[model samples]
Target chain A: MERKTLDLWVGLFVVAGLAAVLVLAMKVGNLSTFNMSESYELKADFGNIGGLKARAPVKSAGVVVGRVTNISFDNASYRARVTMVVDKRYQFPKDTFAKILTAGLLGEQYIGLDPGGDEVNLKSGDNIAKTEPAMVLESLISKFMFDKAADGDAKK
Target chain B: MLERAITGIRGTGHRVVNGVWRLGYASRFFLAVLLHSSMSFRRFHLTIKEIYFSGVLSLIIILVSGLFVGMVLGLQGYETLQKYGSESALGTLVALSLVRELGPVLAALLFASRAGSAITAEIGLMKATEQISAMEMMAVDPIARVVAPRFWAGVISMPLLAAMFSATGVFGGYLIGVVLIGVDEGQFWSQMQAAVDFRQDVMNGVIKSCVFGVAITAIALFEGYDAPPTAEGVSHATTRTVVTSALAVLALDFILTAFMFRGL
Candidate 1:
């Protein structure tokens, strides 16, 4: 009986572990969104996504107000379409310009909205038409390093 | 004696080359055998049942070990990350490490030390008691009957075991981080949540665990099958299974690291 109970407990532990992981995976996989009802989306067209990926934050000024949802190509326009969700409380004006900005020196890039006080509140699925693509620092550093490395002379 | 020595050296060299040649064939054969054994739907169900028995039965030991391990890792990770003033990276480090490499490898090692030895001893005893011979006389392919079930069981159990390890390890790390390392519980969990994604590191852990399981089962099965028919033989095989499985797990880890991290 003791051994049988131990075995049952073991089964429970394994199942619990698996269930926990599956929940986490589902959460990350976006198969299940949590108790979040405050989701407002905005789209932008960029020449390139740059260092942006899905789940990168959508910030207004320096504060994170939302997150990038999905990126797809507008096949006809040859522009990259980015969809993002903004929080309910953070109101945005009509004339806001969204730009993809680098977070830190080496950190991942995110979309930043500069709200213009045009006295009009934006709604869900609005478009931030004015946008700037990301400028990758690594490319600049590579150009600086490799240009010097290949030049044989170490002089600046 | 000299000629025999020369022949032995030549034979060893030939064996190495032959082994290299046979590596692909061996894998193909193993796959074929696996498929052949499970051709019947009944065998497939039996396989799952056996795998559950062999694999899930070891969860308690794995969890207990994983918890302590998580605590130790948290302590170590906190101490090190604090030096660089990036103590917030502790959650990411622990999560990534647990998901990518530590979880699977550690569980495999633990399983090896526990189950590997028992398996080797049990199989050795079966051989010693002529039970295997009796089965053989009844025309059962012992490899397919016994070894294959265990091999499949180990293979199946590994990912589940790894999941247990990672979860407990994370919980353990959480305890150490909040109670001892002086990090806020929210911050630790949030950092872990932000850093760990399914694609980046977690999947890699499962894949590594699966491969490790296959190698461990193969080595254990091989060692067990080849054990001598004596009490001393059982002991030797048990020791060999533990040592060899441990070494093989570590070696496979390096191989995986090289392949996965080479470009990244």
Candidate 2:
């Protein structure tokens, strides 16, 4: 092939490859779209996070409207403080409830937001007071076993 | 018996010394290639041609292998994940495996076996035929004129080939996961989107493929250039190029993965 034609093909190949990566990052990875729009931060405190990570999705009624931007432990309250960056387009009521939820029976954890019947809208820097911690299956199983043993002892 | 034992120890020591010497020589040659390759823009045509030979020609094998691997992953993942009642995560499993690990490593292995070996054979043949020497006689720098362009071409083409491989692999996974296995198509894709991250998974894979490119291409060129100028020497160098590049890619993959995915 002629040099110019060859160069054109190589350039085309590079562009195509980049496009593929872009698609993978956006469609499959859910990366580029998150940062494109304006977002506002809201903080929620949980007793336990249980694999809840930064960058985990924050969904409202099963639709992702934000991401967990930061996760830190509050020394005073002894709670897992999760800072979420919600897209400005999606507004929630001030009384919205945030709970940590797993994708599958034992999959990735995310924040599930349930909107409440409140006239006030949640603004940036608002603290979401009502938060449910992630359910630890191990702890639940242990608790169940302990309850069973205690019931047997009481019957005896 | 005593003399034989002494000779054996000496032989082993000599081999180790020779290996180190060869490593130093190859490093110097690679440095020269890198230096000359900065001027490669001036010889963009040669670089393009090399890329066509190395990257374009290798695409068929990469795509086919990627597709087959993805199909296998989908099949296996569906079977395993179904037992857990989480068959919907087939997309997440396949996409993550391909993008994070298989895409870069497998593409590089194929590239090494295909383009890397070809580069070695071609350059080794040039040396065997005294073509490089002739260029040297004409006051032309063979490393700059011949090796640098091919080196740059291989490096440039590697990451692109890997990305293409991963893309095709994802499609192949979709074919099996969504079409054949009766998986929810939306769940397959959406689950992957929710699971994968740009910096952690995708960018790390790209970084790995880029490093593999440099290492594989360097090994191929160094083997060819340093080969003894004979037909047998050329053949040996070609074989060594494949074997060495494969080992290098795997070892580098392990080290890179450990560092990149350290906290996770």
TM-score of B chain for each model?
A: 0.83, 0.98
TM-score of each prediction = 0.68, 0.89
Task: Tell me the docking grade of candidate 1.
Answer: incorrect
Q: Point to the candidate with the largest DockQ.
A: 2
lDDT of 1: 0.75
Candidate 2 chain B: worst 10 consecutive residues by lDDT? B37-46
lDDT of 2 by residue, B1-264 (tens): 999999999999999999999999999999999888755779688788888899888878988998999999999999999999999889999999999999999999999999999999999999989999999999989998899999999999999899889988998999998998789998998889877888788989999999999999999999999889988898999999999999999999999999987655
Regions of candidate 2 where Cα sits further than 4 Å from its true position: A36-44, A69-78, A81-85, A88-96, A115-129, A141-156
Model 2, TM vs. native: 0.89
Candidate 1 — which residues are off by over 4 angstroms? Answer: A1-14, A23-156, B1-29, B39-53, B228-240, B254-264
Clashes of 1: 0
lDDT for position B206 in model 2 = 92
